[model samples]
Target: MDKTLHYLFDPLCGWCYGAAPAVSGLLESGGVSLELLPTGLFSGEGARPLDDAFAAYAWSNDQRIERLTGQRFSEKYRDRILGDRRQLFDSGPATVALTAVSLTEPARELEALEAIQHARYVDGNDVISLATLADLLRALGLDDAAAKLSHPDAELLGANQARMSRAQALMREFGARGVPTLIVGSGAKRQLLDHAAAYSNPRALISQLEAA
Candidate 1:
């Protein structure tokens, strides 16, 4: 059956970035109504500086993700994005930018998310910066989102917080621990599809979801 799929993720999550192809496949199938849930996992208190230790850890994981999903974590990205200690590993700004996209150009939220991920992991752009995010969205013809992101007001900020809270509540309900959680269906018939399949074989989820 075609069901509603709730995808729980964070803007700064590498695995979620790796799942892009799978996400695209799911969309192409035209079999489900996919709802994105931003968890804000790397925002506020979860945010941190890009220190050497964390950089190494992230790089190691990035390599694995690259091998598994073929999503590049370029040397430029490693040097300019992860290698810079001054950069904050916060998803807050990017989340707000996406919130702007969700509000304005609702159809292209995935496009925006993929662009943000590519900027960080492949193109070596600083996605956590408001100015950078604003520019990126504008480039995608999302001028309204870009304008809103340029100066995030209280309403935008509140919406971002509310989105994260709702995602977190869903995670709690499913007893899920992290990002890339896919919960299919709704109400009493909800089911958690194996997230591993998204990384292993992007198209596998279509069959899995069909079976669900």
Candidate 2:
């Protein structure tokens, strides 16, 4: 039977940054297919401005992530992104950008996610703008792919929505409360891996899935 791994996450999530290394490791192993699901966990309809309180909270959380996962939350983002305090903290554009990239070049979906994340979290670029996203995609040699990201008729849009629905269904199926979740099994006997292990070491979680 073909095995698949469903990775539910929101682009603006801080913990997702911490989980990047493990996710990259899982992909590099070539043992499972990762389905990237985008959840708008932060910022709603319109882009919400980033405030001092929000920045402080994010910095605290990011510091914790850095301490635990060894992921660098650069000083540039700390001083620049948060310092500017002018840009909105919206993930919709970035999420849609990934969806666009996925439609044109499915194989590079993860790379796009990583790029966008690095753009926002490290390089301090605003992922909420079409121009910046296009620039990033072009830099990745995915300019044409990025174009499809904004198309109204792209099938990947439906795929992205379906992925979100599947994630929510899994949540209801497993009594999950948030994104960055994991579900193991094929059909009726599936299990939810909601423990801290799922957060820190996705490889261990995948090992558990293999055992299951």
Candidate 1: minimum summed lDDT over ten consecutive residues — where?
A: 26-35
TM-score for candidate 1, please give it: 0.96
With a 3 Å backbone cut-off (N, CA, C), the pairs that clash in candidate 1 are none
Residue pair clashes in candidate 2: 100-149
Write the residue-wise lDDT of candidate 1 on 1-212 in tens digits: 56788888998999999888998888788768778889989999999988999999999999999999998899999999988988999998988999999899788898899999988888999998899999999899999999999988898888888989999999999899998899898456988888899988877888888778
lDDT of 2 at 44: 57
Q: What's model 2's TM-score?
A: 0.86
Alpha carbon lDDT of each predicted model: 0.89, 0.74
Q: Candidate 1: lDDT of 131?
A: 94
Score every model by TM-score. 0.96, 0.86
Backbone clash total, candidate 2: 1
Stretches of candidate 2 exceeding 4 Å from the true structure = 43-47, 150-160, 187-189, 198-203
